[model samples]
Target: MKTVTNISDLRQQVKDWRQQGLKIAFVPTMGNLHAGHISLVEEAHKHADKIVASIFVNPMQFGENEDIDSYPRTMDNDKRQLIEAGTDLLFTPTPEIIYPKGLAKQSYVEVPNVSDGYCGESRPGHFRGVATVVCKLFNLVQPDVACFGLKDYQQVQVIQTMVDDLSMPIDIVPVPTVREASGLALSSRNGYLSAEEKAIAPALQQNLQWLAQEIQYSRKTSPDHSPDFIGLAKKAAAAIDATGMKTDYIHVSHAHTLQPASEDDKELVILAAAQCGKARLIDNLQLSLA
Candidate 1:
């Protein structure tokens, strides 16, 4: 695999590869390569002749209080994994190379409406930071297809909206979430979990499970699937509390819109976020009352 560390080098390399009639696929990630990221790379390899995976832990997307400096940087090990995964080009660029002017003064992109809720509601300007950097990467790599993990499900939606709105040609492909057998979502933060936290991390998944189970339990007794959305939200909140998590917010909402749905809307998602020890995690489960 070619390890590219500069803008011009990647541009020239991509140009040469395109000249050889190779189709390009890109997977943009922050460096903490795990099975989740490798799964995306594996998906890219299935279709594209060349896969260019970037490892830029974008500073723009991180908040002032967020774990930017503390974010895991396992580059030496990451490179070894990408090589094993059949990645063709590894674009490892600096912040200045990406943002040029840096984040505060840089031009940013935002996807409207859909970016208003879920993680977006809590992390103000997060999607703008995400959308901006992703837009920049799309221009830099100019891949025919860009692969992302479904682990960041809402993020994939926001990015797709941005691509369509701006007429970016890259197709956004969503790969499923890679999980530990414990049912905890595989994330870089998982590394920071204490043994006690790790033992209970599956509670994040179980909270989602509880939300689905409660909604169905209520439905079966009512003979009507339309349980109160606010009540269901409370039930979700209670389930999260039962997990010993400090609550963020919980909702049964339209999976696509992420707007809180009326009770009558049987198709929804149980989205929850909470703090577990030093780490904050989120998980979601789809619930369709039939």
Candidate 2:
């Protein structure tokens, strides 16, 4: 795959592709290549004629105490994986290339409401960094379609809201979360887990699955009664903590708006974040009551 680091060179290549009438698909990621990330590129291959994947460990998206400096950067491996996954072009822009005026002076994008709770609440200014950098990448890549993993459900929602509100012509595709056979959702942070912690990691997904099943069973058996979502979330969080992980937040919300799930809401999602050793892991499950 052709790798370009500058904006002008990247745009020129995209322009050439546009002139050829080739549809483009984009996948933006931090530089830790894994099976989960490759899955995104594979999904992109189905939607467009050429795939454009970017690896910019966005400093804007990371918080003050977050792992920006220590975030994994496996460039040689990442390039090999992308080429194997059929990525046509790789855009590896430096932070300066992305934010010429510096982050303090850079223009930012914020999608209100959806970016308020869950991870947003846990990490202030996180979504602001996410929206702003994603907005910049969307502008630079200008692909017809972009694929994002549903493992980061709120992030997908925030980006979707941003694109719709801004009238950007890019289609946002939500790909399913790829997991290990043990049920652990793959994340770069997973590398931080000790062997003991790795064994406990699958409990996060298990708790979410259990919560989904409980909600489903409650709806089926007690059609007239509203399920106690807040209580269920608390129970799940407690169960996760019982497994030696510290719960950050476990919430049930409307799938679309991300507001607290009400009795009348048919489409719902359960999101959870927990600290397992040095790694902070997040996972979610969506339910369609309709």
Candidate 3:
């Protein structure tokens, strides 16, 4: 597998592949590769002839007090895993290459309302950074299809909205979230957890599952009733807090619009974020009542 750090080099590689009549699939990620990331590459292979993965930790996505400094790099190890996963090309660019004018001077893209709650509420301007960098990557790779994990559920919705609104031609494919046996979603930030914190982490996933069950049961038992979702969210937050983790937010929203789920909404998604030890983790589950 070839790794290119410059846009020109990446373009040439992609051009050559296109000339050969091969379609490209792209997976954009920050380094510190894990099984979940590899699964994204694996899913990419199913959609196109070649897969190109990029590893650049976007600084714009980090909040003022967030741990951008401590975010894991793990480039050497990441390369090994990507090559093992059968990645065709890897793009590893510096920040200057990605944003030559610096973030302050660089133009950004935002999807507005879709990015305003859940993780967006907790980390202001975070999705703007994500939308901008993803737009840049989409332009750079010019892939036939791009793959993203459902692990970042809201992120998937935001990007989907961006593509639809901007009329981007590439297909956005979502792979299921890869999880540990204990149910914690696989994340690069998972490396930050201590042993004790790791044990407490799975509760995030369990509680989300519990919430899903409650929502499903409510739909069945009280067909005409609208369960007080806000009150249920508080109870869910308390359940998570009881696990010794600090809750960020736990709310139910429409699966597609990310607005508060209503009585008539057949598709709903429950999303959560919390701080466990030094790591701030997020997870969500989508459900369709009808």
TM-score, predicted candidate 2 vs. hidden true structure: 0.99
Give each model's clash number.
0, 0, 0
Off by over 4 Å in 1: 217-225, 263-266
What tens digits encode model 3's per-residue C-alpha lDDT throughout 72-147? 8799999999999999999999999999999999999999899998899889999999999999999999999999
lDDT of 2 at 129: 92
What TM-score would every model get versus the actual structure? 0.94, 0.99, 0.98
CA lDDT scores, all candidates in order: 0.85, 0.94, 0.93
Model 1, span 1-290: residue lDDT tens: 99988999999999999899999999999989899999999999887999999999888777767878888899999999999999999999999888777666898887998788778888888888899889999998999999998777678889988988889888889888889999999988888889988888787777678768877888889865576667767766776667677778777778777777766666787777788888888777877885
Query: With candidate 2 superimposed using the best TM-score fit, by how many Å does residue 245's alpha carbon deviate from the native?
Result: 0.2
Better of 1 and 2 by TM-score: 2
207, model 2: CA deviation in Å?
0.8
Instruction: Summarize candidate 2's per-residue lDDT along 181-234 as a digit string, tens digits.
Output: 999999999999999999999999999999999999999999888899999989
